[model samples]
Target: MSFTVAIVGRPNVGKSTLFNRLVGKKLALVDDTPGVTRDRRPGDAKLIDLKFTIIDTAGLEEAGPETLEGRMRAQTEAAVDDADLTLFVVDAKFGLTPLDKTFGELLRRSGKPVVLVANKSEARGSDAGFYDAYTLGLGEPVPISAEHGQGMIDLRDAIVEALGEERAFPEADDEAETNIDVRDSDFAGDADEEAEPEYDETKPLRVAIIGRPNAGKSTLINRFLGEDRLLTGPEAGITRDSISVEWEWRDRTIKMFDTAGMRKKARVQEKLEKLSVADALRSIRFAETVVIVFDATIPFEKQDLQLVDLVLREGRAAVLAFNKWDLVEDTQAVLADLREKTERLLPQARGLRAVPISGQTGYGLDKLMQSIIDTDKVWNKRISTARLNRWLDGVQTQHPPPAVSGRRLKLKYMTQVKARPPAFMVSCTRPDALPESYIRYLINGLRADFDIPGVPIRMHFKAGENPFEGRKKKR
Candidate 1:
């Protein structure tokens, strides 16, 4: 197993910045604001020659067990439990505070190796703070500027010495790239064969859980994991970045992304909030299946409907999840009202699957997962050209295209061009003259006839070539 290091510190001390730097990507959301990271996010980090797993966790804080800060501290403690070493970070520029000493004592009690890091050491007069950090009794502070890439070599050596291995830092000249030999021989036999298409169960299914702030998005994820893998509390907008965790449910690998709850565009004013929202949107676009979480107590808010519409527009397979069902009373009345609203407000996502779940109590989770599997099957549905043309024939016979300027517009042929949000192309006379309503009619017919529900469909019309233009029709 790869060695794991958990970065633990008080709020806003550049822990996430160091994480982003080590991972060589802005994987974690960083802001001047404190307590931005709520979940424990893991990344493959490389420092000089040391490659290992690094976890960026919420900053440690002292609070009552029921408060939001207390929940964040619990998440940090869990990450510490899973780590081979803990990097206790502190701001050298500002000097150590009482909270740092308290956190240091807690880390010491955990019985894990700790490395004290003095961040922002590039600032002048920071040596006093670095010296003071030694009193915490962790070790000599490794002073470095996480923002400017200063003192990394010293930090790398400290980590190597702490791990007690020279393998952590290899010689620069010893590493070489391997080249492959690809000379085909007659003894190799026939090489021209088309491999049969098959599903690879080894690959994890990427699913993004999204909803408005405080809608129990993170809670639902923690429920699925059966552990406090993510921070959850009564606080709104606690989650800032999209954190992915690999999990297995009933023998299937799933990569679940717990994204920051998205607020409406009008309300998202701060730069940090905008970045968080953008990151969430990126998760939705990349995800194979997106579960839109809804608070059953306040179902179908304006932003919720907007997010649903956005998911449909992106052509991603979706399942609507109503969370907090355990607290919901009069389930029949609520479900009936939800159905009416779904039909009225979300006609664009016709036949979408909806599941009622309680993230707190683990109710109806199996059905939620099954809905995702079924929706994915429909999303990847492929239609044979023969079948498409046959369906097109029946559709055109039932409702012929309207005449344009006294000339009948003829739809000649149809064929599926692609799947995964199935797309089709049709060759027709006066394709441009075919009205938008006609296209909608064709799309609707395709959806109903092919049993495509809760997935977007694309249709294209190609004007037919004139028959007499290329031939001498008059003998």
Candidate 2:
């Protein structure tokens, strides 16, 4: 019952920027470009004391259903219909344009509470065209800057007035908004304990390709395959099914899973979209490395960032493909921006290999494919028990996994029990209290010393009581 605020505006009106700001993270892709956002994306939005769901719709453009903009229009219209309140944004610096007016008219007719948001009002004389916004007849304009974080107080007050008293938040029932993201079939059905897995079949390495819808995932797959096997389109949701292709690169055969674009689980309503997300998660279970393809035009969107985060949390290897580099302007400046923002935002994905390429033009595709090969090599890497204990001895001397229950928990031994996910069994007492921070240290050391990349790593604990606690040991 939480009132939803749909940020509806024409292309490049700062809707995604505001969405990211409200979400308190750089979840949406923002650039000095127009029409970069396409899907009707919803996220946890906040404005000081106000916490509500915010929907960032694609730019509304004048086009027919056959065109991309027209499809975007359908998504935007659907978002408007689903929301309880709406914010009609306009580029105040560019002055009110016809598209803004058309968007305003559309919102005005919807009978939902509307707030006129005039964005980019931070610079001097920026509001010179504020008067033009009045013609939309949505009421007094809320001049705000999403990038500079200006006028948030006013925006918050306006949001509270619009929907604060309407109803309670719908998500209040769910204690935790489970952030379940990427899934692939390969990640599923791997709990076989007795049957020895064919190392040859499983050792080829598993890779999952994922990102927001229309983030060039299919194009990248096609480029790697050297054929037009997968369907590609500019519209979102072109590839509704996850397809697996078995191929080899330099005698190293690998299983590549091309999955549908993954978004927040709560926002997925369409049947096809749900199936795609489920399949992506399955892939993640088995994929050693997940290559996230992002549209250079709107790279690092909320869904994109979430997808990467899910991989790291699941302890999988990660790579990022900034696809469509050919369409991005000012490559140098953009890379610098990406470095700064990505460092501050995606801390979990620090040190992740990012490759800029155009899947359509084949620019930098070879490098991307090679990087994948190298990362897979790292992913399958293993270390001897002697080398691990040696490294562990050095680490323990430097700093040990502190004491709990006054016992000073000891890590007696460790060994690489399996590959694929690159799992290890640690022989240690009091396994339940092993702090997560210590686990991270062990993971970091393993990755650094063994040089693994883009694969999930599992660390198992075996208490030293006995191989059989109640039963007698082997006679």
Candidate 3:
């Protein structure tokens, strides 16, 4: 098993910055604003030859149970509990604050292996703060600049030493331990007609649940886990960051993400809300399958439709679900209306899977889980070159391209470039001149012919180049 490290510290200590630096990607949003990271974001970090899973958590803060800061602290604590080691970061430029001492004491009580990190050490006079960090009693602070990428080697060594020999050499054991338990759902539903999914014990399927404010996204996740793992209340926008949990459904390993409830652009005035929306979008992009949850009573709002469109544009498979089903009096009417709206409003994602569920009562939770597994199957669907080309022939013959500038556009060849949205590349003359309508026609044809549904289809048109002419330079 890879070593798990959680970066924890007081607000604005550059923990997110350091996380972005270590992951070698802008996975987490970094800003001068304190308490920006509300959820625990996990990423695979690489330091030269060292590889391990790293979690970027919200800043440790003191607040009452009802306050937002208090909830953020709860999420961070959960990350610390799950981690094998913790990187206790402190702001070297600002020196140690009262809050830093509190966090240090908290980490001490936890008794987890910790590597003290003093961030912003590249600044002038920052050495004083680095020295002050020693008082925390964790160890000699590894001073480094998370923004400027300085002193990483020292930080790497510190982490390696903290991990020790057992974790560093994982290959020593013939079988790696998997924490996920394989169990079947209580409901007895037949698996989809598609080939039995090849379950990979190593990688968990990444699933994201997204919706507008107060849509019960967190509630749904909590219900699926059979516990109140995620904090939920009657308040809208309680969840401000994308928090993920390792889950198992029907013996399948799944990494489920409960994202911040997205409000319309006009309503998002505060800087924090905008950050939350961005975090939710990132969760959708990273997820293998996204479940667009909706409150059944008021489903299909403008924002909900927009979220569905965004997911399709991102080339991710989606499952539409209506939460609070127990509250709906006329269930049949609501379901029918939703089906009509789904077809009329979101034609791009035709044949989208929909499930009615009650997050509060746990009704239809099994169906929702089944849809997620099925949607993921379709999302990763791949068609062979031979089958793709054969279908392309029939599609072109059925609806030939219209003449452009008094010349017919010659379609030469077609092949799938990749899957996970199943991208295709078509080689033909005057590819740029092809109309959007024609592209959609080909996309829909490919979708229907391949029995691919509920997932986005990507088609790229390329102008066919003459092989002989390219071989010899034109004189």
Candidate 4:
């Protein structure tokens, strides 16, 4: 079994920076702003040869049970409880505070092995603060600068000493640790006669939930998790970092991402909010399927439409989640209106799936999950070259490409270049003369004829014959 380490401390102590350093990726959002991380985020960490799971948690604070700060503190405490060892981090440049001492006593009572980490020790006056950490009675402070990558060897030695040499390095297992699953779904396809490989059951699907501020993005994810795994409240922008959580539904592994709520570009002026928005966009790019959450009370706001458009442009499979369904007294009427709006406003994502869900009460969650699964299958659907050419013949017969400069464009051949938001390339006599309207016509035909809906379809027109048609083997 792999050892688990949780970094806990007061706000702005470089816990996230240390986590990014150990993970060798910028997986967590780092800023000078305290309390940027409210939920406990986990990553696979390595130090030289030592490997373990590292959790980055919110800043420890004192607040009432109902306040947001109190909820953040609760998450931090839970991380400490679940960890095998705790890295009690402190700001060496700023020295120890009263809250640090209080949390130190708390960790001592828990009886978990604690490693005091004095962060930002590269600063000129950090020696006094590093020495002050010894007074907390945890242990000798391992002085290190998380930002500059200083004293990492000392940190590794301290961890190995805390966990004995044998416990630190366990036997390696041959089984692969699943991250993102890239297997094709079980959706029936007309592309090829040969059977595709079955879905990999062990791999996990990556789904990103995103929308405008106060759309209940976090609440919806928390409802799916059946716990407050994310920091959520009545606040409009409670989440600033895109946090990913691994889960299982009906024996299928899924990795769900809870992203920060986005707002209009003009309204997003703060540096921190911009960082959060960028992080959310990154999640969309990496996700296999994206769930666009909307406030059912005020569905299809301007920003909400912009978000859906962005998802379609990214060529990602998308589903609309109308959150706060419980607030609507007339469900039937509101759902009908929402469906009409989805069709009219989101023409780019034709035939998009929409589910009415109440994040607060867990209503319609099963249906939402089903919609996500179905949409993912559509996203990964593939079409064979022969089937595509046959479909192209029918589409042209129904509506030929418009004539430009009194000469009709002749589409010679068509083939799907790739799946996962199916992209196609067509070789035609006058590629430049083919109007944008004609391209849309062909894309629409592909969606309706091939059962590929709700995902972006890329169709490129190239002049002359297919590039690979006459290529000969050099070997």
Candidate 5:
């Protein structure tokens, strides 16, 4: 097993910054605001030759178990228990506070090996705070500036000392056994006229659950995991960072991302919320499939429609999950009404799959999962060049391209350029003269004919060159 390390500290002590520094990527959100990270996020980190799993946790705080802060503390404690080593971080620029000392004692009592990390040591007048760290009884502090890439060598040495060299750097035979099996077909083929790659079942399917605040996104993900893996409550915007969890569904590896709820732009006045929303958008961009959760009682709000449009524009497969089905008295009528609204308001994503589910009671989750799988297949669907040309012939015959400047436009050929949000390229005369209405008609025809619905389709037209003019005539 890989060695696991957890970064734990009170709020705003640069714990996230330290995590980003160690991982060499900005996986964790860092801001001046306190308590920005509520969920425990794990990433594969490599410090020079030492490779291990690192978890970034919320800043520890003292609060009642019922409050949000207390729940965040519980998450931090769970991370500490799960890790083999804990890096207790402190702000060296401003000495240790009483809360930090209390958590330091708690970490000591937990019996896990602790590595004291004094962040922001590059700043002037931080030596006193670094010296004060010794009073907490956590051993010598490793002074490092996480933001400026300073003292990482000392930090690596400290970690090796804490976990022992054997555990930090395992035998080569032990490390070689962890290689994942990836087939040649798993990678993309040639650049021009490339065949669609087969979906690698061995790889995990990335699905992101996103919606407005308090839309039961976390609850739905927790139900899928069959545990309280994500922090959930009645409060809105409880989750600040997009937390990803991996699990098996029907022997298939699946990774689910629970993102911070996005709100209207006008109401997002705080910089922290804006950062959270941007993170959520990044999740959508990276995800192969997005499950847009909605409150069953308040279905299809204005922001919800806008989010749907955004997802379609991003060229990702989407599924509408109407959560909280148990609250509805008239299930059939409400579902029918929801279907109608989805059709009327979101015509761009025609035939989008909508499933009603109750995150609390675990209703319709199976259907939702099945829908996700089906949408993913459609997103990766590819068509052959010959088949595309045949379909193009039939489509153009029925409804020919309209005339522009008294000359009829001719569509000579068409072929699929790529999939995963199916895109097509068409060769025709005067490509720019084709009206938007005709392009929409052809796109609709392709969607209906190919059975690729709801997912975004891209089509581009190019002017075809005359063969006779380019070469000498046979006569």
Candidate 6:
């Protein structure tokens, strides 16, 4: 149920720059050279409240008409095929070129939604070229300077209208989705029921490694798999699609996936890039706990951060894996900085555990595996109501739900609703007023006290008194 926008234009049109601006990362290797981006990089593209997947494509080129460049262009064309909207970028400073015209014609012929973007239009002399964008027939071109961050508001409105998303950034503001299990010992009565299923400790928890291209995602996976199953090098981007492998660790069947590297949007110009990143996301959905890998050299680039955000948003428990730990100097300083940045940069999924390891040298692999095991435990944890209600009572007593419309909403009780990305349910007078910050506090508390680390936790607030008040509600 995700929407998509494909960024297509000739090379060196700042398509990757615009992609980095929207996805908030320098994921695409930017150079003065044309066609620097060969692979298609897709990220969870967001413009304020407009949430959609964005594909940063390689620049179209005039190759031997059937060579690699030609085939690459063909891939770019295919990206346009799947997009709900296309961002047609042009270099306003450089003016329109013949290649631009050719692709422009192809885009128009596709008959899909298109938004013409005249990037690098901040220079005084760029106006004439920006004006020429009108001739492309993609509609009134929005002049934007991706590097300097100009015309964003106008671009925001345009995207909102084009994608049909909200005008404001989404509410990171929903009530918790946790429901406590307060059923009596025999509440879940079943004619065919036997003893409760024994919690299997021997099962190797399924885990995944996901991140933008060149963020050391494959490196991390290699360390866990204990071999170089996937190729790794200094190349800016190497992964092409999701690769899954199975291994046993301490009698646990740990399945790991090394996924295609995702670049920020504009860099993803080819059809192959789109297919690659999509495959990685699909892997995350199947993983119980996904390890979002980050390059130790440049941790938390906008695209890498967004990938982590996407995993949690997709309802998967996530752990932060800082790869290439061996190359980093002053390890403690880096960890401290990472902790600070994660807390500030990713406030939505708070209390996420971060472990540093060198995927190449195998440093800290043991700790990483332990952390994964611990996080998986949290992901599958089901909190007992007696303990939960007690915690909720104390939390409410300390900091009651804030008043809404001069009517104080009372949160009567809470219980663990489910497990596997553990969910909690809070019965309250007005569930609407439960602040996001408060719910986060409860999750942090649960993680710390109950040893639930690294995975995502959900807490839900239901209106009215406890669902099981007085006579127990049916389990």
The numbered model that scores best in lDDT is 5
Model 3 residue 447 distance off true place after TM-score fit, in angstroms:
6.7
Cα displacement (angstroms), candidate 2, residue 30, comes to 37
Give the alpha carbon lDDT tens digit for every residue of 1-475 in model 2: 2568788888887998899888887545565567656656567776775667788778889899877667668878888888878888888888888777777887888888888898998867766767778889988888899999999998877776766544523446554554444433433334424333332332465688988888888778778788655656666776544556667766776668877787778889865466557767877766777888988888778888888889877766778888889998899999887767676777553456788889888898778767776665554455566767778788888788889978898888877675544677888988999998998888777766776644556789888876667886687
Off by over 4 Å in 1: 166-203, 465-475
Candidate 2 structure lDDT? 0.74
Q: TM-score of each candidate? A: 0.88, 0.52, 0.74, 0.93, 0.93, 0.55
- What's the lDDT for all of these models? 0.85, 0.74, 0.84, 0.88, 0.89, 0.75
Residue 63 displacement in candidate 5 (angstroms): 0.4
| Reference-based lDDT, residue 241, model 5 | 86
Pairs of residues clashing in candidate 5: none
Instruction: Give the per-residue lDDT of model 6 (tens digit) for 285-398.
Output: 777778888888888888988888898887777888888888999988889999999889987666787888887788878887887777766666666677777888887787
In terms of lDDT, model 5 sits at: 0.89
Select the stronger candidate by lDDT from 1 and 3: 1
CA RMSD (A), model 4: 4.3
Model 3, 300-348: lDDT tens per residue? 9999999999999988889999999999998898889989988899999
Shift in Å, residue 439, candidate 1: 1.4
Over 4 Å off, model 2:
1-206, 245-255, 283-288, 312-316, 339-350, 466-475
Higher-TM-score candidate of 2 and 6: 6
- The best-first sequence of candidates by TM-score reads 5, 4, 1, 3, 6, 2
State which candidate, 1 or 2, has the greater TM-score.
1
Worst 10 residues of 2 by lDDT: 192-201
In candidate 6, how many Å is residue 188 off?
14
lDDT of 4 by residue, 166-218 (tens): 88987767475445446444232435443434444455789999998889988
CA shift at 142, candidate 3, in angstroms? 3.2
Clash pairs, candidate 4, are 191-383, 191-384
